[model samples]
Structure formats: C-alpha cells, structure tokens
Target: MREITGKQITDAIKKLVIEANYKLDDALIKKFKESIEKEKSETGKRILEQIIENAEIAKDGVYPLCQDTGASVIFAYVGEEIVFKENGNGESILVSAINKGVSESYVEGYLRKSIVRDPFDRVNTKNNTPAMIVTEIVTGDKMKLVYMTKGGGCENMSLLKVLAPAAGLEGVKQFVVDTVENAHANPCPPVFVGVGVGGDFEKCAYLAKKALMRGINEKNPNPFYAEMEEDLLERINKTGVGPQGFGGTITAIAVHVEAFPCHIASLPVAVNIDCHSHRHKEIIL
Candidate 1:
C-alpha cells in the first residue's frame, strides 16, 4: 500500500485554494471570449469584454476574481491502494489536514472569509475552515482532487425538484429552463448551468454541484446527456438574460448535465447556477 502523509495533502490543498481564487480557469476565459462574439447586444458584448479584462488583471494574483472568496469545496478520489498517514491527532487525519490547509490558505492568502459557524447564529468563521469535503475510493494508487470555490450568490439560486416519472424528458427540460428564467439576474447572468437529472434528492444536488467542476467547454461524455446540455444552453440563452442580466443573446456560457439511475417512481432534477467567475481547479497527486 502507498502511504500519503498528512503534510502532503495539507500543502496541496493550500496551494490549490490560493491559486483557484487568484486565477480564473482557462476554459472559462475561452467561453467568455466566445460568448462575447455570440452576444448581439452592444451592452452585453461590453460586459463580456470587461469580464475578460478582469480575468486578465486577476491572473497577476494581486486581486481575486470575485469579492466573495467562497467556501472551499473538495471532491477527493482516493485510490484503494493508498492509505493516508495519521497526523497524531485523534480526529480523522485526512479531514483535519484538509481543513487546516483551507484555513491557512484563506488566512495567509488574504482572501475574504465568507463561511459562517452557524446558519442561525451568523458569526463568521474568519478563516474558512471545515471545507465541504467528499471522498470516494477508486482503483489507482494516487489521489485526484477537484477543488471548487462555491460562491454564495449562485449557490443560493440553485434549485431541486422531484418530478413524477410521468413528467418525463419534457418536464426535466422545462424545469431547468424555468429555474434559469426565474433566477434571472440573481445568480449573475452569463452563467454556467449545471443540471443533475435522475438520482435521489440529495444525490441529485450533489451531482449538480459536481457537474460544475467539468470544464466549461467540456460536454457530458454520454451523447444523450450532451445533446440535452446543448439544448438547455440554447433555450437558456434565448431567455435574453444577457451578461449580468442586462439583456442579450448570450445568457449562459454552457449547460452541463450529469445523470444517474433512480427508482422508477421519481425523477429528481437539480439546477446549480454559477456566475461568470466559475472558479475551480483540479490536481492529481
């Protein structure tokens, strides 16, 4: 078995968190440029241009792309052949290390602290600790980490609905389009829409959030879902929400759909919206 040290995980997570906030993903930048060309409205085109400029400036690491630094969300695929070494703490070494890394990155990198200790109490965490971590075991010896900085505005606008199986494909399509239409400007226009179809209630939401990690230019591997993604993108842009919801032809940069099997009785669909600065990073170690 391969043993991975706690420090290695901590250092890697710290680096990823700092970089993800400071640098916009290249795929997203390309989408912005493409969106600019597709945008017919003069105002929308200008907004897209400004977004590209902002990304350029943020690349220097002087300022983050968005004021909301976001909560650190990680999807870790750990190999069954690997084992994480204990950190001498009684708690789960992996979890503790990840949280330590996240807290340090937020504090040392000077990113805004947005996570709160409690939903009702509303006190700031100050260091953005306790990252939302999901771990899955796979076959390889290495670990693959997909890190995302999930901002509140778009996350708050995400929705899930349990449709009767009879609602079928048309229902799923309408639900996704309606969610984007109802979201309007709240999630910020020129958004990336991640749609999760099938799966149970919570699983569907998780799938929707996970869907956001796919590169903006990448399509679902399954042709069926990929075609649905394309259709959703077309339908959403036709809404004319435009850049920042100012009104234009390029409302959504891309629509990604992830699906899983579910019981025959229910079809759970989730729409997770992400603003123009859809910040995510991935690394294998």
Candidate 2:
C-alpha cells in the first residue's frame, strides 16, 4: 500500500488554498471571454470586460479574485489501497492537515477570515481553522482532493426543497427558475446553476454542491439530463437577469445537474448557485 504522510497532505492543502484564492480557473475564464461577445447590453459588455480585467489582475497573486475568500471546503476521496501515515497529533491525520492548511493559507496568504464559531454569537474564527471536510471512500489506489472556495453571496442564494414525487419534471424546472429569478442580482448574475434532482434530503444538497465542481463546458452524461440542462440554461438566461443583473443575453454561463436514486414517495431537489467566479481545483495523490 502507498503510504501518504500527514505532512504531505498539509503542505498540499496549504498550497491549494493559496493558489486557488489567487487564480481563477482557466475554463471559467474562457466562458467569461465568450460571454462578452454574446452579451447584447452595452452595460453588460462593460461588466464582462471589467470582470476579465479583474481576473487578469487576480492572476498576479497580489490579492484574491473576490474579497470573500470563502469557506474552505475539502472534498476528499480516500483510496482503499493506500495507508495514511499518522503523526503524533491526536486528530485525524487528514482533518488535522486540512485545518493546518486553512489556518496557514488564511493567515500567511492574507485571505479573509469569514467563518464564525457560532451562528448566534457571530464571533469570527480568526485563524479560519475547522474547515468543512467531506470525505468518501472510493475504489482506487490514488487519493484525490478537491478544494472549493465557495463564496457566501452565491451560497446564500442556494435552495433545497422536498417535492412530492408528483411534482414531476416541470415542477423541478419552475422551482429552479424561480429560485434564480427571486435572487435577482444578489448572487452576482451570470451564475452557474447546479441542480440535484434526486436522493434523500441531505444527499440531495450534497449532489447539488458536487455538481458545481463539474467543468462548465461539460454536459450531464445522461441524454435526458443533458437535454434538461440545455433547456434550463435557456430558460434561466430568459429570466433577463443578465450579467450582474443589468439585463443581457446571458444570465447564466451554465447549468449542471447531477441526480441519484431516491425514495418512492419523495422527490428532493436542491440548487447550489455559484457566481460568475466559480472556483475549484483538484489534486491527485
């Protein structure tokens, strides 16, 4: 079995956090540039241009692309054939490494600390420790980690609902469009919509978040869902929310849907909205 050390994990996570903060993914940048040509509004064109410039500036690493550096959420896939070498630290090796990385990146990288210790008290976790880590055991020998910098503005606009199975496909469409339209301009328009159409309550939400990790240029593998994604994209853009909600031809850059099996009586749907800057990076070890 391959031995993976805590030190390696810690260093990798730290670099990822800092690097992800400063750099916008190239695929997303391509979409932003393309959207500029399709945008009809003069104001929208200007907005897209400024966005492109901001991305270029951010690539220089002077500051993060967004003021909200966002919550450090780690999606970990552990391999069955590898052994995680433990340190003397009592914490789970992976958890400890992730926390250390977050703390170091937020402090040393000068990223913003937005996490609070309590919902009511509203005290900041100045060090940005205790990052949210989600792990799963996968059938492979290589471990993988995906670090997502999820900003609050778009996160707040996300929605989850338990619909009756009878609600059907049309209902899913309406709910998703309504959720985006209701947000108006808050989530920072030209959003990427991730829709989870099945699974149970909590799983449905997870599916939605995972869906956003997909590249915007990709499509759902299932032909039905691929078509659904296309229709949803067309409808959401029709909302006229446009770039930064200034009314344009492109309200959303993409719509990705990930679905799983669910209980017979329940149809759970979740929508995770990501602003124009949908950021994430993956590392295979």
Candidate 3:
C-alpha cells in the first residue's frame, strides 16, 4: 500500500482553492465567448462580454472573479490501496489536512471568512475552518480531490420536491422549469441549472450539486437527458431573465441533469443552480 502524508493533501487543497477562485476554467470561458456570438439580445451580448472580461481580469490580477468567495467544499475519493498517516493527533488525517488547507487558503488568498462557529451567536470562524467535506472509498490506488466554491445566492435558491411516482417525466420537467421561473433574478441570471432526478430526497439533492461541477457546456451522455437539457435551456432563456436579470434573452447558459435509481413509489427531484461564476477544481494524487 502506498502511504501519503497529510501535508501533501493540505498543500494541494490550499493551492487549488486559491487558483480556482481566481481563474475561470477554459471550457467555461469558451462557452461564454460562444454565447456572446449567438446571443439574440444586444443587452445579453454586452453582459456576456463583461463576464468574459471579468474572468480575464481575475486571472491576470490574481483576484477573485466574484465578490462572494463562497463556502469551501471538498470532495475526496480515497482509494482502498492507499493509507493516510496521521501525526499522532488521534484525528483522521484526512480531516486535519482539509482544515489546514482551508485555513491557509482563506487567509493567503484573501477569501472571505463566511463560516460561523455558532448559528445562534453568529460569530465568524475567521479562518473559514471546517470545510464541508465529503469522502468516498474507491477501488484505485490514488486519491482524487475536488474543490467546489459554492456561492450563497445560488445555493440558497436550490430546491427539492418528492413527486409521486405517478407524476412521471412530464411532472419532473415542469417542476424544474417552474423552479427556475420562480427563482427569477434571485439566483442570478445566466445561471447553470443542475437537475437531479430519481434517488431519494437527500441523494437527489447531492446529485444536483454534483452536476454543477461538470464542465459548463458538456452535454449529458444520455440522449434523452441531453434533449431535456437543450429544451430546458431554450425555455429558460425565453423567460427573458437575461444577464443579471436585466430582462433580455440568454437567461441560462446550460441545464445539466444527473439521475439515479430510486424506489418505485417515489420520484425525488432537486434543482441546484450555479451563477455565471461557477468555480471548481480537481486534482489526483
């Protein structure tokens, strides 16, 4: 078995947090450029141009693309063949590494300290400690880490519904479309919609959030779902929410869906939205 040190994980997470916040992924940038060319509304096209410029400036200046630095989320896939060594702290090495990374990155990268230690007191944690970490055990020999910075505006607007199995696909489609329309300008326009279907309530919610981590314009491999995505994009744009909800076309850049097996009696669906500045990064070690 290969043994990995906690320090390595800590350092890697810190660097990823800083880098991801400052730079838009190339795939997302390409999509924005394409949108600018095809956008029907003059206002929409101008907003797309501003977004592209914001990304470029953020990368060149090493500044955050959006004012909201977001809550740090870490997804770790630990291989059964690898072992993590703790330095006699009695804490899980993995947890320690994550905390270290989060603290260091938040301070050095000038990220906002958004976490509160006590919900009642509402006191800031100062270091953005205690990252929301999700860990999975896998078959491989290496660990894979993903960092997703989720902004509060879009995250707060996410929703889930448990539909009777009788609701069927039409019900699912309407629920998603309705949720976006209800959200209006709240989640920020020009959003990326992630829809998760099937799984139980909680699982579906998680799946919806995970879907947002996909590349901006990547199509779902399932042909039916891909068509659903395309159709949803068309319908959402027709809402005329426009960029920043100023009223125009191009309200959403993409609609992604991830579904899983579920009980026959229930159809749990979730809608997770990401604003134009969807930020995430991944690394394998």
Candidate 4:
C-alpha cells in the first residue's frame, strides 16, 4: 500500500481550495463563452461577457469570482490499495488535513467565512471550515480529491423528492424542468443542473451533488440518461429565464444526470443547482 502523509493531504487541499475559489474551471469558462454566442437576448449576451471578464480577473487572484466564497465541500476517493498515515495528534489524518487546509485557505485567500458553528446558534465559524466532507472507497491505487466551493444561493435552491415508481422518466423530467423554472434567477442564471435518479433518498441526494462534479461539456455515459440530460437541458433553456434571470434564450448551461439502482417501489430524484461560477477542482495523489 502507498503511504500518504497527513501533511501532504493538508497542503494539497489548501492549494485546491484557494485556487478553485479564485479561478473558474476552464471547461466552465468555455461553456460561458459558448453560451454568450448562443444567447439571443442582448442583455443576456452582455451578462455573459461580464461573467467571462470576471473570470479573467479572478484568475489573476485579485478577487474571487463570487463574493460568496462558499462552503468547502470535499469528495475524497480513497483507493483500496492506499493508506493514510495518522497525524501525530491521533485524530483521523484525513479529517485533520481537510479542515486545516480549509481554514488556512480561507484566511489566506481572504474569502468569506460563511459557515456557522451551529444551526441554532448561528455563530460564525470564522475560518470557513470544517468542511462538508464525503468519502468513498473505489477501485484504484490513487487517491482522488475533488474540492467544490458550493455557493449558498445555488445550494439553497436544490430540490429533491421521493417519487412513486410510476412517476418514472416523465416525472423526473418535468420535476427538473419545473424546479429550474421556479428557481427563476435565484440560483443565478445559466446554471448547471445535476439530477440524481433511482437511488434511495439520501443516496439520490448525494448522487445529485456528485453529478455536479462532472464537466459541463460531458454527457451521461448511458445512452438513456444521456438523452434525458440533453432533453432536460433543452427544456430548461427554453424557459427563457436568461442570464441573471432578466430573460433570454440560454437559461441553463447544461444538465447532468447520475443514476443508481433502486428498490422496485421507490424512485428518488434530486436536483442540485450550481451557479455560473461552477467552482470545482480535482487532483489525484
């Protein structure tokens, strides 16, 4: 087994958190550029241009792409063949590393501290950590870490439901499209919609969040889901919610769907909305 040091993980997460907050993903940038061209509304086109310009400026580190630096949402895939060495303090090395990175990155980057210490208390965490961390064991020798700055606006607009098995495909499609239409511009316009279908309630929600990690330019690997994604994208854009919701042709940039096997009677569907920033970064170690 390859031994991974806690310090190494800490440093890596810190780097990724800061960089992702400042620089928008290249794939997402490309989508914005393309969206600008396809946008029929003059106002929408102008908004798209400003978005591109903001990305360019943020890339230089002068400021983050959005005022909301976001919560540190981490997805760590620990390979079966790898072992994370414990830190000296006896805490879980992985958790320590992640939180340390999150804390340092937020302070150093001057990003906003948006996380509260408790739901009821409503006190600021001050450091923007500890992260909302998720881990999965996967077949591989390399540890892959995906860091996403999930903005509150878009995250708050996410939706889910446990549909009857009979609801099936049409139900899911209509639900997703309706969610976007209802959201209007709350989550920001030209959003990427991640849909999770078929899994149990919680699993479906996780799948929906994870689906946002996929590149906007890529489609679902399964032909059925791929078609569904395309259909949803078209239908959502047809809403004319436009850029920043002022009204235009390209409301949503893309739709991504991830599916899992479910029990016969249950069909759980989730929609995780991501704003135009699409702040996510990945690294393998």
Candidate 5:
C-alpha cells in the first residue's frame, strides 16, 4: 500500500488554486478565439474580443478573471490502495489540506473571500475556509484532485426537473433550451451549458457540474449525445442573447452532457451553467 502525507495534498491544492485562477485554460482560450472569428453579429464579435482581452489581462496581471472568486469545491478520487495519515489533531487530514490550500490561495492570489460562516449573522470567514469537498474511493493507486471555483451567478442559474419516463430525448432537449432561454443575461452569455440526464435528482446535479470540467472544444464521445449538444447550442444561440447578454449570435460556447441510468418511471435532468470565465483544473498525484 502507498502512504501519502497530508502536506503533499495541501501543497498541491494550493498550487492548483493559484494556477487555475490566474491562467485561462488553453482549450477555453482557443474556443474564445474561434468564436470571435465565427461570430457573424458585429456586437457578438466585439463582445468575444473583450472576453479574450479579459483573459489576457487576468493572466498578465496574475489576477482572478472575475470578482467572484467563488466557493472552493474540491473533488477527490482517492485510491483504495493508498493510506492517508492523520495529523495529531483529530481533524480529517484531507479536510485540513483543503482548508490550507484555500486559505493560502485566496490570500496570495488576491481572490475575494466571499464565503460566509453563518447564514443568519452573515459573518465572513476572512480566509475562505471550509471548502466543499467530495471524495470518492477508486481501485487505482494514484490520487486525482479537481479544483472547481464555482461562481454564484452561474451556479444560482442551475436548475433541475423530473420528467416522466415517456418524455424521453425530446423532453430533455426542450428543458435544456428553455432553461438557457429563461436565464437570458443572468448567467453571463457565451456560457458553457452542462446537462446531466437520467440520474436521480441529486446525482443528476453532480453529473451536470462534472460536465463543466470537460475541455471546451472536445465533443462528447457518444454521437447521439454530441448531436443533441449541437442542436441545443443552435437553439440557444438563436435566442440572440449574445456575449454578456448584449444581443448577438454566439450565446454559448459549448454544450456538454453526461448521462446515467435511472428508474423506469423517472427521468431527472439538471442544467449547470458556467460563465464565459469558466475556471477549473485537475491534478493527479
């Protein structure tokens, strides 16, 4: 069995937090450039150009792309064969590491500390502690970590609906298109649409969020789903919501879907939207 220290995890998490917020992923940048070229509406093209410039400024200035640095969400895949040693305190080593990472990154990166400790009192944590962690045990020996800084605007726009089994593919398509159209400029246009279908309600939400981590230009492997993605994008852009909802042709950059089996009577669907500044990173150790 492989033994991994908590400090290593903490260090890696800190690095990922800094890097992800500062650097725009190449795939996302490339998609923005392509969108600029293909955008027919002059207003849409101008907005796309500004998006590209914003990314460049964030990278050069080593600043966050958006003011809402977002709550730190960490997804960990720990191998069953690996053992994690707990520190002297009873606190979970994993949780401690994540907190350490969040604290260091928020300070060093100059990210806004948006997390509040009490909903009633609205007390600020000051350092952005208590990261939202989701852990899974797998068969492999290596640990994989994905850091997702999910902003409130797009996250609040997420929606879920339980459709009758008979609703099938057509229902799913309508729901997705309708959700985007209703969102309008709220979620920040030129958004990435993440659709999760067929799972239980909660599972569907998880899958939808996971879909946001996929590379921007990468097509879904399943041809049927890929076609659905294409169709959904076409319909969403037809709304003319354009960049930042200023009115244009490029409403969304990509539509990514993840699916799973569900009960015979139910078809649960979830839609998670990521804004133009979609930010996430993965690390394997």
Candidate 6:
C-alpha cells in the first residue's frame, strides 16, 4: 500500500488554493473570448473584456481576480490502496492537514479572509480554516483534489426545488430558467449554471455543485443529458440578462446538468451558479 504523509497533503492543498485563486481556468478563458465576439451589446462586450483583463493581471499572483477571495471548497478522491499517516493529534489527520494548508494559503498568499466562525455571529475565521471538504474513496493509489474558490455572491443566488415528480423535464427546464431570471445581476450575469436533477434534496444540491466542476467546454457523457445542457444554455442566454445584466446576447457562458436516480415519488432539482470569475483547479497526488 502507498503511504501518504500529512505534510504532503498540506503542501498540495496550499499550492492548489493559491493557484486556483490567481489563474482562471483555460477553458473559461476561451469561453470568455468567444462570448466577447458574440455579445451584441457594446457595454456587455466591454464588461467581458475587462473581466479578461482582470484575469490576466491576476495571473502574476500579486493580486486576486476578485475582492471576495471566496470560501475554500474541496472535493477529494482518496484511493483505497493508499494509507494516510496520522499526525498523533486526536483530530483526523487528513482533515487537519487540509485545513492547515488552507489557512496558510490564504494568509501567506495575501488572499482575503472571507470565512466566518459562525453564520450568525459573523466573526471572521481570519485564516479561512476548515475548508468545505467532501471526500470519496476510489480505486487507485493516487489522491485527487478538485479545488474551487466559491465566492458568496453567486452562491447566494443558487436554489433548489422539490418539484412534483409529475413536473417532469419541462418543469425542470422552467425552474432553472426562472431561477436565473430571478437572480439576474445578483448572481453576476453571464454566469455558469450547474443543474442537478433527481436524487434526494441534499444529494441534488451536491450534484449541482459537482456539475460546476466539469470543464466549461466539456459536455455530459450521456447524450441525453448533454442535449438537455445545450437546451438549457440556449434558453438561459435568451433571458437577455446579458453581461452583468446590462442586456446582451449572452447571459450565460454554459449550463452543466448532472442527474441521478431518485425515489419514484420525488423530483428534486438544484441550481448552483458561479460568477464570471469561475476560479477552479484540479490536481493529482
């Protein structure tokens, strides 16, 4: 069995959190360029252009792409064949190491500390500790970490609905489009939408967030869902929310849909939105 040390995990997380905040994903950059060409509104085109420029400046790592450095979100795929060494502390070594890395990255990298100690008390966490980590066990000996700096603005606009199973596919489409329409500039226009269909309430929300992890250009492997993604993208852009909701031809860069089996009696749907920044990255260790 392969043995992975806590230090190794800490170092990896630190690098990933820093890198994701500084450099926008290549796929998203390409999409922005394409959208700039397609945008009919002069103001919308200018907004997209400025967004691209901001990304370029942040690539130097001296500054972040947005003021809201965002909460640290991690999806960890741990290989069953790999053994993680304990740190001798009572706490879980893996979780401790991950949080340590996150704290160091935010503090040392000069990223803003946006996390709070409690939802209501609103005291700042200072170092952005206790990252939102979701771990899954997989077959190989290597560990994979998918990281995203999820800003609050877009996250706040996400929604979930437990539609009647009778609501069906059309119902799902309507909910997603209406959610975007209701959000408008609040979620940051030209958003990237992630839709989760089926599953229970919580699982549906998770699925929607995972859908955002897919590459901007990547289509769902299942052709049925892939077609649905395309249809939703078209309908969303047609909302005329435009870039930053200024009114334009492209309101959304892409719509990604993920689905799972659910009880016959329930149809749970969720929508997770990400603003233009769309900061995310993946690494294997």
Best by lDDT: 6
What is candidate 6's lDDT per residue for 22-42, written digit by digit as tens?
Answer: 999877888899999999999
Cα-based lDDT for every prediction: 0.90, 0.89, 0.88, 0.91, 0.87, 0.92
TM-score of 4: 0.98
Summarize candidate 2's per-residue lDDT along 1-285 as a digit string, tens digits.
789988788888888898788888888888888999998999999998888899899999996889988988899999998888868768788899888888988999999999999989989999776898889899878889889888999999999999999999999999999999998899988899999999999899998988898877889999999999999999998888898988988889999999999999999999999988777888898
Encode model 1's per-residue lDDT on 81-163: one tens digit a residue: 99889777698878888898999989988999998899999999899977999998899899988899988999899999999
Candidate closer to the true structure by lDDT (higher is better), 1 or 6? 6
Lowest lDDT block of 10, candidate 1: 86-95
Q: Can you tell me which runs of candidate 1 are displaced by over 4 Å? A: none
Show where candidate 3 strays beyond 4 Å.
Answer: none
Candidate 5 residue 239 Cα shift, in angstroms, is 1.7
Instruction: Please provide, for model 5 over 65-155, each residue's C-alpha lDDT reduced to its tens digit, 9 standing for 90 to 100.
Output: 8888888888899999988876889888888988998998898778899889987998999888788888989998899999988888998
lDDT for each residue of candidate 3 in 1-285, tens digit (9 for 90 to 100): 989899999999998898788998988888888888778788888989999999999997467988888888888989999989757989999999989999999998888888889879988999988898988899978999989888889888889999999999889988988888788888877899999998998899888887887777688899999998898888888888888887777788899999999998999999999889988999999
How many residue pairs clash per model? 0, 0, 0, 0, 0, 0
Of the pair 5 and 6, which is ahead by TM-score?
6
lDDT of 4 at 52: 94
TM-score of each: 0.98, 0.98, 0.96, 0.98, 0.96, 0.98
Could you tell me how far off, in angstroms, the CA of residue 186 lies in candidate 1 after the best superposition? Answer: 1.1
- Per-residue lDDT tens digits for candidate 4, residues 85-174, read 866787899988999999988998899999999999999999998899999999878999999999999998999999998987999899
Q: List the residue pairs that clash in candidate 6.
A: none
- Model 4 regions more than 4 Å off: none
For candidate 1, the clash count comes to: 0
* Residue 270, model 3, lDDT: 98
